[model samples]
Target: MKKYGLQLRAPSQQKKAAARPPLPPPRGFQEDEDDDVEREISRQASKNKALKDVEEQHKKALEEDPSVFDYDGVYDEMKEKVVRPRVQDREERKPKYIQNLMKKAEQRKWEQEIVYERKLVKERSKDDHLYADKDKFVTSAYKKKLAEQAKWMEEERLRQLREEKDDVSVAFSAISCDGFFPLREEERLRQLREEKQPSVEQPKGDHHKRGGDAVAAARERFLARKRAKLSLVL
Candidate 1:
């Protein structure tokens, strides 16, 4: 067994993953535009061995095995540290259901419910010791600054809402004046009534003219009413 060092990425890390190597064409296979299905299975075993080597190295560096490193009053994994969980190698573990595993797989890939761990790198143990003591001070300042920011944010949000209300009121008045969109039909009708003109008066004296006009007018009205009723029924 060999010891190795673990390097963890910081929050500010923004590096992209390294580009994959160009793939070779499959052996005894034709090279069509969509012919990437048959991989060279011969190389898979080599790839697996390389992956195992890397995993072994990572375990030596980061993992706390069951039988290693027992210290006094404190188990050392992180700072004054702690004993990590005891992992066991089992020969006969029960197989998981495909549907449940599929659901978990979906969650892990898309929703990120699956947690991944990376160890923090310390330049020196002394620096870690300092942070443990002053974390409360840092936390307090951070909280106060957050509170101030939230207060301003809330105030601006309310101010925006008030401006929106004023805009709505102005738009209502403009639209009603232009008659584009009637916000309140009752209000529009009331305004129309206020701006109404008086009706003209008609003469009422000639008997023969009045009798003929009244009979013609009554027949015309009856015909108009009949047409309207017929139209409605149709």
Candidate 2:
């Protein structure tokens, strides 16, 4: 059978190794020393030549333009021509009219602030007055209530004193007179016994009298009400 599309081949022979140049023979001690000295001398000479060339160019530039070295003068001129004027313009004061307007605005603002503060103070004072009035009303009402309570207490105390005095008088009256006649003493003792008894059963005549008085009072009240009704009707 024929070989496939591409035939496989062995790798080519390896390339020959490159030959290195032969190194020079070792120099004598004096020769190596002389070579090093020569190289150092050439390097230093070249460096000095480069520095001298730079110096000459700088000297020529200074001669061509004397102003190149006039640093302070140039700086002063630049400041005078460019920087100072711009700074002065930036820092310039406002015109009188503008200043006046600004002052007016500030004054108006201060006046408005003063007005607002006064308003606040007035409102605060009004509120304080209202609070004071409320507190006064409460305090006065409390004091009045306390006075009423004290008056009621005094009235009650007087009523109690009167009751106690009446009781003492009744007790004193109940004591019989010493060394009186037997009949009078007996009569007095009987009166005291009667007085000590509760008066739950009033006399029939007194009861009738009281009932008549109540009836008359009721008749008077009824007449008054009827008269009031008739007046409304009329």
- TM-scores for all candidates? 0.22, 0.26
C-alpha lDDT (0 to 100) for residue 170 of candidate 2: 40
- Model 1, 98-182: lDDT tens digits are 5668865753442221111111122345467767766443478766755754575465457556755555555455444444564
Q: Which lDDT value does model 1 have at 171?
A: 49
The residue-by-residue lDDT of candidate 2 on 24-141, one tens digit each, is: 6667876988899999999999999999999999899999997887989998998789888777776664466688899768545544544554566677787785677464343787
The candidate that achieves the highest TM-score relative to the unseen native structure? 2
Q: What is the lDDT of residue 35 in candidate 2?
A: 92
Number of colliding residue pairs in model 1? 0
As a whole number from 0 to 100, the lDDT of residue 55 in candidate 1 is 83
In model 2, the runs with Cα more than 4 Å from the true position are 1-27, 69-82, 91-234
What's the lDDT for residue 33 in model 2? Answer: 85
Best by lDDT: 2
RMSD of each: 45.3, 46.9
